[model samples]
Target: MNISYQLTQGQIGMLISMPHNGQLIPDDIASTMTEKAKLVPDTDWYMDKLYDFAQAMGIATIIPKYSRYVIDLNRDISGVNLYPGANSTELCPTTAFDLSPLYLDGKSPNEAEIQRRIKNYWQPYHQAIADTLADMRQQYERVVLLDAHSILSHVPRFFAGKLPDFNFGNADGQSCSQALIDKVSALDLSPYSSVVNGRFKGGYITRAYGQPEQGIHAIQLELSQYTYMDEPSDQYNQQKAEQVKVKLQQFVTCLADFANAKS
Candidate 1:
């Protein structure tokens, strides 16, 4: 069993990744965290639930079992900042987005511990992604990858004011073909705001594996949690969730069709 994550094969040559959806914290690690950190507020709460429709769409999906506090799989294993100039989080973040300490005083994971987390958590997730794509690529010439994520609407540490409801990133058009991007960019972004290649222009997973020239295209979508969640409380809003999922199903279906046509 791949204890690190859950993966399912797709019939449509597409993969959806939710790296931060994990909320499990090993007791050994939780013992070192602050009271607030133990709650795992930084998690992409309920993302697996939010994107559950992908499974019905025959889109392969993968979600990690451990919290990002264990290791940020979206981040580079070397701990390089995906956005160098901006305030960014690390592979094993010692502090929360609000600059609050996640660990107790001097109880943070050190360099050695960070490396251990990478080996234990990060490596497995990426290897599964690479391995699955390798197997799928043999059958399908071009496979589309959708990296899904969500965040609080107003994270001052990352952006000012409220964030766009839908933030699409394709590593600034290098990760996917123009045809794929145009299709996603042309979505009916009414009522909700959206921007392409804005504050978040994709992360390690999109940049590292997205080789459009090599017949692998990737796109990262960052949604505002307000779109489907009641924040702080994480109450399930079936009405809000259904509305968003309808829109997502349309987008993913278009993406899959576009990738095949381009290939």
Candidate 2:
């Protein structure tokens, strides 16, 4: 029944998530979407591939099977706004990142339908994350959850200027320990920049599950698509990926060491 995702568990105490990389949409839902929306242009395209090194490294990985247009698993399912002043998409976003409508006229889901989608699509994904973290905690003294995500370099709706190549979020340090942050921050992504606690300071998954005091450290990295892919066009280039994969491998190696580090 959990047909909406792919979960792979590695021997290590880390979990890599591609929550928004899904592209499938139910027939009924797809029929109601506009041509532009059908392309799912705003998705974290090729993120699962970008993070493929995690699988080889034996890190637990979880990815959704349905498009984020179905339910924003990164968002709070309770309907509370994650970014109040900023123009953000909802749990069931009806518009693209550019503010263009996704649904056909009057075909968007209503409140009752939104709740139904949450129960069917959203809750299961979250429960899987929670359960995985709990299970990992039982096996390792510490667990690191790396939430992987990406977007266009410049989405005028979310931020004013171009986004950094790496946007690491730890819920202002509440979702993780300073040690882990320091390790990742020291990465030298030359020609590519990074920021901690910037415009994107983690989302619901990081804020809700990260409990460093309890030995669970969570971090969310929102990468700029241009760093590893052809931006706006959304193409996946092998040469580009190969280059970025080197840096990513370094990043994941750091997380694995942090998780297995002795106290």
Candidate 3:
């Protein structure tokens, strides 16, 4: 079997997590899914290419190997909703973002299968994050996590209209310090709209890992696909990516600086 994830170590106090970056759906699972499910449409497309610049900045990163259709890496193992009383996907999702059924009739994984996936896939990716953060905690005074994600510009299932280009979620100030939030809020986000603690206020990873009292901070940035790619075609747009990367660089630099700063 392919490794559960790829971990790129770095000499810094930051880790960039691309939890939904995987696009591969195993054949056994694929055989049970619908044609639309086979497409893995909800996968966060091209995040590896989008964040490729992080490697040169001495930033660590963790990206999983299997599509989220297999198991959502950002969700808690207990299968609690990240956003309670709101429309959300399951730990082992049964449908796509558009509410389309992912599996064929009665082909969804059973409880035992879900447990197997948790053991084989979810645990390793999260363990990697925990281990990396532990190591960074020992090396730096402050450790930061940037949970990177991208979504369709308009997913009516979740929200009414087009999403803000950049959605920053710090779990309503539970995940990071207000000073850091203020610093981020002060950045020039002209041309592209943004909102903090908006529709998406971080997921399990950010909430679980972020502990300001422990000198660890976390934030989730959910970018709209329209900002850097042709959403319909799902193709990379160099011009778009270049333009957005300028802003992204500033955003990440701020997070890195926050991590490396002395108390």
Candidate 4:
């Protein structure tokens, strides 16, 4: 199946990527997942809507259609753990963060099947990202990539306690330019202080393609579900979401201004 990409009318060519917002499950894969997994509660619910402002600002975007459970596009295809000591999902997760089995009994994909899934799903998503960056590089002198993500504020399975409202990851400043990071940090995002290379740093997409010297900058914004959604469930809360959107708009707008001024 072909991957999907959404582009805005921006001459600036900044790319906003929502790699984990997808909720689609292929027919074959859907057959193997349990009812709980099919609900896709772990998804970055409504992230596309969260970043809808980007379209108006003429920023292009790339969003995957299939769910991350099918194949995590943010993960390292080489199978290296994004978090070494901490628990994490694999290239094709067999269990959910809650430690519940995602696949039906005896229906999990084997090694060969996993390889096939990667070839079919994982590769294309990254390819779209790569192609977008290449195009942006050609069109503009500098390109900014923002990888969007959301997760439950409290996942005891992964971390010790509740997470902050905003988690900004740049692979410890290795992913993007200091200017970009400084610009993002300057926002009055108080009570939402960001961690540079904390528990959840930049993922595969942020680490692999972010070349500051090459004029391509990437940063991952991992928002706590409480910032927008109702945690532990996938329900949408308009009032709370709007409040959060104001802060996020400031965050992205800073990046846009920085990119425009720098470029």
Candidate 5:
């Protein structure tokens, strides 16, 4: 099946992505998932709306339509786990963060099916991202890739306590220029203090695609769902979301400006 991508062409300074916000499940796979998995609770719900400001600011975005449970587009295709020993979902997650089985009895994808998914869904999503960056680099001297994501404020399996409002990960400074990182850090989000290269020190996409010396910078922003969504329900709160969006706009615009100037 062809993966659908949303692309908004701009001057190509930075390319923003919402890889996990999708909810579309292929019919074949959907039939196998339990009711709980069908809810797609672990999705980065409403991330596309959260970053809608990108289009307004002339920043391009590439978002997938299928859910991460189908195939985690952000993961390494070689089957290597992003978190190593730490708890993490697979290419096609069999269970949720709460350890609930996603698939019904005897319906999970086997090795052959998994390989088929990798060829069909996983590879194309990443190729699109790589292509966008390549195009951006050709047009501009420097490009920044902002991988947008969100999670529940507290996932005990991953962290000890509630997470900070904004968790910026740049693969321990290997993904981007120091200036780009500093620009994001300078935002006056004092009320919601952020952590740079913390628990989520970027994902496979951020680490693999980022090449500072090559002038293709990448960073992952993991926002706590509480900052914008009503947890458990996954409802969007306009008032609370607007407050956060304003800061995000500022953060993204700064990166755009920095890229424009540097380019």
Candidate 6:
């Protein structure tokens, strides 16, 4: 119902998407949620802050204004599981990352409510992605989407042990080009761990939008929260963020160079 998101146009063919960066829950929606849900602890906290370099680098970006609790923008419109046979949340999630109930008894959104959210929240966000990518494809020989996110180092519901600092997912090489993958994998991410096509093999955004044949590449970077923030306090650590930003800058530069390369 409200302004769904913010869009920043860029001089280059790179678009950084932070679908889970938001933490705001409408007062009306907040009233129906449990105390833990109101906290919005599952958010991809401070993603915009961490990726501030994108602006100067002439990269475009789209940021959501509502929490994923309102509706997961990165998910499919049909509510299909992004990861089947695995414990996962819903498009209109009823539970948090810890598998705890988000809504109070009898407050969970039913089918009708879910439809409304899809129409209002989900549709608009995805439309922006589609339109922006389409425009990029028109102006450039290649365009790359960096779907950015951050999570706590450990979430038992999804994985057993601590997550790597940088988790790159390209839907098992179906999403982006092998060249871009090689570029990122070659980065010197010292003092941090990284994996490709591992636990996170890209989400809906990467899977749906990435079309290497069409010259539009998409990849997801699921960062470990401990790399840039104080997990216990949910606060930004400037020193820590600066260090991670260096690597992120390298990744972006590679993506930009890839996009600008002659086809």
What's each prediction's clash count? Answer: 0, 0, 0, 0, 0, 0
Per-residue lDDT for 197 in model 1? Answer: 98
In candidate 5, stretches whose alpha carbon ends up further than 4 angstroms from where it belongs are: 1-3
RMSD, every candidate, angstroms: 1.2, 1.0, 1.2, 1.7, 1.4, 1.2
Q: What's the distance in Å from true for residue 170, model 6?
A: 0.3
- TM-score versus the correct structure, for each prediction: 0.97, 0.97, 0.98, 0.95, 0.96, 0.98
lDDT of 1 at 131: 86
Overall lDDT per candidate, in order of appearance: 0.86, 0.90, 0.93, 0.84, 0.87, 0.92
lDDT for predicted candidate 4 compared with the true structure? 0.84
List runs of model 2 lying over 4 Å from the truth: none
Worst 10 residues of 2 by lDDT: 77-86
* Model 3 segments more than 4 A misplaced: none
TM-score of 5: 0.96
lDDT of 2 by residue, 15-106 (tens): 98888999998988899899999899999999888887787788999999999998899999787887777788898999999999999999
Q: lDDT score of model 5?
A: 0.87
Q: Give the alpha carbon lDDT tens digit for every residue of 210-255 in model 3.
A: 9999999999999999999888667889999989988998999999
State in Å the error of residue 118, model 2: 0.7
C-alpha lDDT (0 to 100) for residue 135 of candidate 2 = 99
Candidate 4: regions farther than 4 A off = 1-9, 191-193
> Which lDDT tens digits does candidate 1 get at residues 171-225?
8899998988998888886767899999989999999989888888999999888
TM-score of 3: 0.98
